[model samples]
Target: MTWKKLDQIRRENPVTDEEEYGQAYAEASLAFELARLVYGLRTQAGLTQTELARRMGTTQSSVARWESGGSLPTIDLLDRLGRAVDVRLELVASHHDPTSSKDSPSCAVAFGAR
Candidate 1:
């Protein structure tokens, strides 16, 4: 029984079927990124999960779920969150060469405190 670093294991056994796992990976990555963004906004605004949820007209569990990456929020929810935190949300989309190794088109969501 030996210890192995997670990154080492991943490097040794990379995903061979991109067609199967690519979409899931991209979705998970986006969820994680959005979770971090939500958490950051809440903390930066000096609000607790309950407080933020109240401001967003949602429940604290919903905020916790968002922060934990358990669910992906919709644009309408994002807009409400931005309003609650006094930040501006900008969603940008860009196309990339399909022939490239990338799995899909690039999209970014920017949050700026107002």
Candidate 2:
């Protein structure tokens, strides 16, 4: 059956049981994407770990730890990193058409308003 048909059926059958699965998938996906973005931006700026450390006003080892995934950054750090590199991060998102019947629910991701 088509998604539209499935969605119609789902309206009557709300699959509440899958909520935890959907939330975990979303969290994992978002974290992975964010880490990739930070690594990509740092490399594209032609910055060494030391250079990025200087720009971030921290230590090279700290930068290395963050990049190596021993440390994760806060949202505020992400904005600062983008500023230091002079490139804006863009996250494009959209509604999964209501008819899609996907297990994942819609969410708000932090794409810069600019």
Best by TM-score: 1
Model 1: per-residue lDDT, tens digit, 1-114?
Answer: 335687788889999999779888899999999999999999999999999999999999999999999998888889889999999988877676667655443777775345
Model 2, range 21-45, lDDT digits (tens) per residue?
7997687676666667767878999
* Model 1: pairs clashing at backbone N, Cα or C within 3 Å: none
lDDT scores in order:
0.88, 0.71
Segments of candidate 2 deviating more than 4 angstroms: 1-17, 59-72, 90-114
Name the candidate that leads on lDDT.
1
After the best TM-score superposition of candidate 2, give how far the Cα of residue 81 lies from its true spot, in angstroms: 0.7
| TM-score for each of the candidates | 0.75, 0.54
Cα-based RMSD of the predictions, in order? Answer: 5.2, 11.0
